[model samples]
Target: MHVKFLIIGAGPTGLGAAWRLAGHGENDFLVLERHAHVGGLAASFTDRAGFTWDVGGHVVFSHYGLFDRLLDELLGEAVLRHQRESWIRVAGTFVPYPFQNNIRRLPPELAWECVEGLLAAGRDAAAGVHPDAPAHFRAWIDRVFGPGIARLFMVPYNFKVWAHPAEAMSHRWIGERVSVVDAGRVIKNIIFGADDVAWGPNNTFSFPLRGGTGEIFRRLAARFADRIRLGAAVVSIDPAAKTVCTASGETITYGRLLSTGPLDRLVADQLVGAPPALIEAAGRLKHNGAFIHGLGFDGAPPDSRCWMYFPESDCPFYRVTNFHNYSPFNTPDPDGMRPRLRALMTETSFSGYKPEDPATLLDRTVAGLAATTLTAPDDAGRLVSTWEMAVDYAYPIPCLERDAALGLIQPALEAMGIFSRGRFGGWKYEVGNMDHSLMQGVEWADRMVAGSRETVYTL
Candidate 1:
């Protein structure tokens, strides 16, 4: 089979590119997806008990007008807007999200420590005596947040979430993700106990009212489904020859190729006879896997909070989301024959340094809920549904070596007429959100058609 434009991985990135192609009245393109459904890591499903769970915690906030308009068209009135109510659990207390901003919620003494550190940090910044750039995430935390807040929450909480010590991570990729502390606002909020929320674009987000996060992608894929080949996993690719072999033992050649899977896998494993240094660089690419554990319970009223972070060692899971609070449609209805149930979703990370056994993860996640005061004794006893899923490429870890490795591999692939684009394709967590990933696809399609520059996934 020969396609004018051949694509791999029918997730958001591929679908986004395909949609752009369709918008331009180009229908000769075909998208090859390994899975039967779309959405990649953003996918969602309803369990046997009729409870919907996302791949993990997924909320939609846009940084682009095209993506916003696409959602408006696909979801229309069914889109549900939400106010962000995120929190963090540490020192046996639930502090507001971005823990540094709400130090007053901590115990008086610890809160004092955080305040003192913030003041000291402010003093340092005023003096203009800090590193031009932090050596790593750990140094960045200590420098930006000061030692008090870093030790109390930033260090430990980030450790759990990333499943790697802060020192192992690079500070280059946290462009807009990390919230910097504002001493004046922090002091004001602390003095009067005022909630200083609404920090980022996600302060107010939107979701589908009916389906889980997947519904958005599913609806988008519907527009270009005729060009999508589901369950067509590409086993190998001959980049030099511009051909891909699917699992069905069929060979498909393409004029231009855009792959949305892991860049490391494409170069090292899939692309036959790639450069040795590129393969070695691909090996250096690091990622943390995810284990999602969900619990549904029979309850009258669920916790109204959106999501909470864990910085302590009390819980194996780094972050927990009150999934039911995101949407009532996430759980089953409470008719006379059935009891309405609320849901809790937790995610644990695993890497060589912080390995997690899938067998014990479910139990550990349940115990973690109780350990962190998320569940009461009564609520713990009455269980309704439990489900767990794993994604191999949860986070593309931005290490000291990540960009250097990408600097080597991406250029080589593009030279061979391949455009690797998407979350893992670009491997830039800073630009790896739903909006960024989709735009990467859209821009890649535009670049292919009009010789435009690809900004988001630039080599």
Candidate 2:
């Protein structure tokens, strides 16, 4: 079979492209998804005990107006708006999100240490003692946040989340994702005893009222279900013939191909006759996997905070979300009547740099929760249902070699009528959020159908 446009992996990016193409009244496109269901990494699952959980801790927040309008149209009144109440667990206490901004919440001595380090960092900047540009993420953290915050939170927490050493990762991708705090603001907040909690774009976000985050994509996919081919994983791509072969022995020919799978696999494994340099470049692109655990309890939640970060090793998971708070329906009670069930979702990342034993992860996660004071020792007995998902491609690591690698691979693919744009496909963490991923596809479709210039997912 043949088509004008062919999309691989019916995740946010592929769905966005198909949706936009359909909106433009184009009908020659087909979406091929390996999974039987939609939503990709953004998919959700309902456990045996009726608790809903996302692959990871995904909140509905957008930097684009297009995404906002789409959400409004799709979810309508069936959505929940939340003021983000995120915190960090450290130094035997809970510090507000952006741990650098709330050092006062730490123990007095630790707070002073953080303050002193901030003062030292300020002095270094004033004196022009540090380099104009930090070499890597580690240097950037030390230069911007100083030693105390770096040692306590930035270094350890980042290592856990990314599963990569700070020195190996690039610092450039940290725009807006990280909060940069100065000494004066921190000191002033500490003096006033104020909580500097509202610093990021996700301070206020939205969620589906019934299903988990996956509900958004599920509803979108239903619009053109006839065009989507589930369980059809692409096995090979003959770029010269503009043909794709699926695992089911189906051969599809297309004028244009949009690949939302991993860039490395697209180049090194699937594409035919890929140049040696391009294949090597693809190999250099790094990524980490994630283990998501959804733990359901038979009692009320332990806290009011939306999610909490753990920099310490007491918890195998780097972050935990009070999933029940995202939506009451996330628990067993759809009517919001029974406040007895608690849903806690945890995310732990792993890569070659950091290995985890999946066999022992669940037990360690439960023990870690108690060790971090998220639950009591006896609460383990109250655990009614537990669900876990291991994602192979979770976060795309922004390593030092990423840009150079993309530089080599993306252009070659585009020249051959293949456009790869998404979290793993584009291999850019800065624009890898849900809104950005969808916009990348929309932009790609706009460019394809209307000669519109693509802005997001540019090399």
Candidate 3:
């Protein structure tokens, strides 16, 4: 079989590309997804007990006008708007999101320690004590937040989320993703006892009223259902011949290939006759796996916060979302008129540097939730359903070697008429949001159809 454009993986990127191609009246494109279902990591599932859970915590907020319009067109009135009420759990209390901005909620001594550290950081900056740019994320944390906030929140919380040591990762990936706080702002908030919760781009987001976050992508994929082939995993790609072979023994020759799979796997395992340098570069690309737990309880949600970040070891998971709050239908309540269940979605990241025993993760997660005051000890008995999924290629680590690896691998593949984009494909955590991932594919389609320059996934 042959096609003008062949897209691997029916995730957000591939779906976006296919949608754009069809929108532009181009029909000679095909999408091959290894999974039977679409939406990739953004997919949602309804447990037998009737709780809907996303692969992890995902919120619908856009950085592009195209994505905004697309969401409006897809979800319409079926979407719900939410003001982000996120917090950090530390010192036996809840500080508002952007913990640095609202250190006033902490115990007096801890808050003062954070304040002192910020003052010291400010003085150092004024004196030009360390003028050189930070070499890694660790130094960047210390330089920007000072030792107090770094020790109390930034350092530990980051490690929990990334599953990699800060020193091994690059600070360049932190654009709007991280909120940098100053001594003055922190001190002022502490003095006035004010909350500074609206800092990031996702301050206010949208969600599907019925289905979870996956509904957006699921609806988008239906438009070009005939062009998608599920359970057709690619086994090999011969770049010289522009051919792709699936595990089902079908060889497809394509004019141009768009791969949304992990860039490392594409170069190291799938691509035929790759050079030593490219293979070595692929080996350097780092990523962490995620263990998501969708715990359903026989009561209303325990908190009003949308999600809470856990920095201390009291919890095995880095973050927990009040899943039921996102949508009433997320719980098993048949009528949706009166809610009776609480859905807690927790995400724990693991990597070579930080390994977790999945066998006992559920018990630990339940105990941790109670310990952290997310649920009462007796609430474990109230747990009616437990849904868990482990994603091997979860967050693409922005390591010191990432850009260098991408620099070599991306160009080499592009030279062979293969383009890799999306989260793992581009390996850029900064632009790995849902909107960014979809736009990367849309931009790729634009480039293919109109000779437009691709901006989101550029080297």
Candidate 4:
């Protein structure tokens, strides 16, 4: 099949690109999705008991005006807008989120130490002793919030998320994502004994009121009609000839290619020609996959908090989301007949330092849940339905080696008339949310069609 644009992956970004391309009256494109479903990592599934679960934890906080309009146009009034309430489980206490802002919750001794550090940092900032550029994530935190908060919340919490120490991550990506504690506020809070919660603009986010996030993609693909081919995985991409071969033995030639697949896997296949150094660096990009352990219960949502961060060492999973709180539709009606769980599913694999087993996984996640005090040990066994889904690409690990690696790979792909965009494609941890990913794909398509500059990937 000859097409103007050949896209891979039918997830939000892929579908968004296809939708935009079609809406622009440039409908000469075909999208190939490996999975039978439209949404890639955003795909949702129902347990035997009819409770729906997203791949991991996905909530929408639209960055662009166009995104909000598109969502409203497709899902109509079915989407639910919820107030986000997130916290962190630290030292056996549920600390309000943006923990740096809530240091009053810390024990008296720790709070004093943090305040001392912040006072020192405030003086330094006023004197302009810090460097103009932040070298690493740790330095960035320390300079902005002071050393004490960095040691307590920023350092440990980031370690849990990135699987690497803060020193290993670059600071160029920390803008707007990491909260910097204001010295004035910290001192005022210390005097007034106030806790800083609800510090960021993302306190309110939106989610589809029904059918999970995947519903957005499903409807988008439907709008595109036959342009999208589900269960059609691309086996190879020959950039020299501008053709892609699918697993189903179909060859598609296109004028432009916007690949949303992982850069490492894409180059490993040599489907498209990339520089040798880039391919080598692509191999060096390190990431740890995730196993989402979703539990459905027969009662009202557990807590108003949307998600909780785990910084302590005992828990295998870094963060757990009380996803039901995202929207009323996430869980079934409490008064309605809650179906008995028909089965329990557990998935396990090796990614990090130690290999995890399915049996051990069940125990670890359950125990972690209890350790974080999200659940009781006794209530662990009562989860009628539990699902453990292992996703190959979950949190993109921004290790010390990541920047150098992506630096080599991205330029190489750009030279081949291929734009590798989206979460895994760009491998950018910052701005790697659903909204950013969708814009990444759309921008790439726009860049190809109208010579518009890439917005999300420039950083």
Candidate 5:
């Protein structure tokens, strides 16, 4: 079949492009999703017992006005807006988020170190002395938050998440991600006790009323049902001929292509006529794998906080979401009041199967939870319901070779009028959030449809 636009991958990025293209009403498009469903990592699943789990954890926070508008239009005003309450796992205590800002909550010595570092940073700044060159992620952290905070929170916490040392990563990608407190303000706050809750874009955000993030994409696909083809995996793309071959052996032709597949896989394996440099660059793109362990409980909520960060090495996951806190729909009935049973007490569960005894997994998760200080001992063994989830592509690692690699790859595709884009697509962790990814798709579509340049690409 021939169409004006052929979109590969039905994830949020692909869905967003399809949504915008259909809304534009000026093009005939077809969306081919490798998965049977539309929502990619943000997809949800319902158990026979009625528990729901989102892929890893997804929260909707927009960096663009257009993304915000699209979500509001699609999900509507009934969506729940939540004030984010997140924490960091530190020295066996749950410190408030942006942990560098809350050093006072840490032990006396660590707090003092953080305060002293702030003071030193102030003196250094006053003398107009800054690092002439920040060559690594560690240096970047030090420059932005000072040595004490970096050592205490940023470095260790980030280490847990990325599973790679800070010194090995690049500093150029950390511009707006890490908060750089004014030296005087940080010290003054330490002395007089000021809280830095209003520090990031995710301080406040929205969640769906009926489901987790998957609901948003499911609805987006619903609106453009005729153009969407789920369970139809695009196995190959011959860009020179503008054709896509699917897993089921169906062939499709298109006038223009918008792909949201992984940068490496798309050009290297899937695209039939990829250029040499694009394949090489795709090979250079590196990402971290994540095994998301979701534990569903049968009792009261664990904490009011939305999610918690882990800097410690004990827990396997760098972050854990109180998925229930996203909405009532995320868990079973709150009023039903089932007793929570604890299952496994270890960080890693080797018993691959879902434990018949729900308490076993819950126990293990709670033990790890307590070990991580994410939960209390009193709350460990009572979970009656339990579940664990895993995702192979939860994180895109910013390896030392990422930029140099993508730099070699992206331009070659661009030269062919193909824009490599999305979380795994553009392969830029600096700009790979849901909003950023979706906007990348929309902006790419705008560029393709109206001869406009993409701002996300420029950024």
Candidate 6:
């Protein structure tokens, strides 16, 4: 198929580009998705026992109006509005999220430690205390939250979630990604035991009422169904020829290309003639994989919590989503008489830095859930279905050298008629949320057709 525009990977980014192109009366484009479905890393699945599971725990929260309007249009009345009630399990206690702000939930000694550190940090700041510029994530944490919060929560929590030490990562990508503590409000909440509901961008988000997160992208893809070639994986790309060869051995050419796959995969694995330095830089781009373990219960959950974090070392999972709570349809027997019929999706990070033994991962996850009190003791036998999914590129680790690598790779691809944008495409975890991913594609389309400046991906 020859077209004016060729898109690789039919995820949010590719869909955004295609949707935007269609808005411009430009239909001479084709989106090639390797999988039989859209949504990319944002896809969802149903287990044999009838529990719906997303790629990871995805919630709808947009920084762009375009994304908001599109979500409203696609999901319509099938949206499940939710108030985000998230928690952190530390010192064997469930504390409200933004662990620093809710340090009072910790034991009195620990709480006193946090408060003392906060007061000391404040005093230091007042005394014109100056420290060296924070060049890494660990230092940034210490600089912002002081040693107390960092030692108690930030350092340990981040290590568990990222599966990489904070000292090895860069701090530049942390723009509203990690909620910084408000010392005054934290003290107030701590003194009064106030449970603050609103915290992050996803404090109030929504999901599909029925089909998990994938339903949104499925409906969005139906808009230009004819132009989408499902299960068409790009095996090779010749930038000079402006053509892509699929795994099925079909040769399709395009005038322009927008890729939503991993930048490393495109350059090192697919694209021919990528610069040597670009290839090396791509190799240097560190990212961790994810093992999404879903468990379906015949009974309800321990609590009505939306999601919770496990920062301690005992738990294999960093975060566990009350999948059933997201939508009743996520449970097979939602209307069934069982008191605790629900689903819990746990995310475990795996990479070279944190190699996970998959054979016992599910076992570990179940134990972790019980240990963290996400499920009841008897819920083990009640597990009707256990589903495990692996994502090779779950998060783009913002190492100290990440931007330098992106600088070398993206411009080279752009000059060669390739615009790589999305969560993994751009690889900027700060702007790598669902909304940001779609907007990256939308802005890319706008940039291509109207010469508008792209913001999220910053091309």
Best by lDDT: 2
lDDT of 2 by residue, 1-459 (tens): 999999998889999999999999998999999998899999999988889999999998998999999999999999999999999999888999989999989888999999999999999999999857999999999988889999999999999999999999999999999999899999999999999999999999999998899999999999999999999999999999999999999999999899999999999899999999999999899999999999998875547889999999888999999998899899887665655788999999999999999999999999999999888889999999999999999999999999999998898889988999999999999999999999999999999999999888887
TM-score of 2: 0.99
Tens-digit lDDT track of model 4 for 1-459: 899988888876787788778767898999888887888888888767656788877787878888888888888988778877777777668778888787778788887878888888889888989758777778878877777777777877776666556676778776778777776787687689886776675878878877888888778788876888888888888888888999889989988888887778888873666557767787788776767777765433346677777776777776777766655556555233554221212222246643456567777877777776766567655676676687777767777788888777777777787777778878887857888888887887787778888877764
lDDT of 5 by residue, 340-365 (tens): 32222112212212112334444445
Which runs of model 4 end up more than 4 angstroms from their true locations? 126-134, 270-273, 299-302, 334-358
Q: 15-39 in candidate 1: lDDT tens per residue?
A: 8999998887778999999998899
lDDT of candidate 6 over 35-152, digit per residue (tens): 9889898899998998999998899888888788998899889898988898888888888887877888889999888888777777876776756667799988876788878887
Against the reference, the lDDT scores of all candidates come to 0.87, 0.93, 0.92, 0.74, 0.72, 0.87
lDDT of 3 by residue, 106-144 (tens): 999999999998899889989999889999999989888
**Which stretches in model 3 have alpha-carbon errors above 4 Å?**
334-339
In candidate 3 the C-alpha lDDT for residue 65 amounts to: 99
TM-score of 5: 0.89
Q: How far off is residue 154 in model 1, in Å?
A: 0.9
Q: On a 0 to 1 TM-score scale, where does candidate 6 land against the true structure?
A: 0.97
User: Where does the lowest 10-residue lDDT sum fall in candidate 6?
Assistant: 124-133
TM-score-best of 1 and 5: 1
Residue 126 in model 1: lDDT: 86
Stretch of 10 with least lDDT, candidate 3? 332-341
| Winner of 5 and 6 under lDDT | 6
Number of backbone collisions per candidate: 1, 0, 0, 0, 21, 4
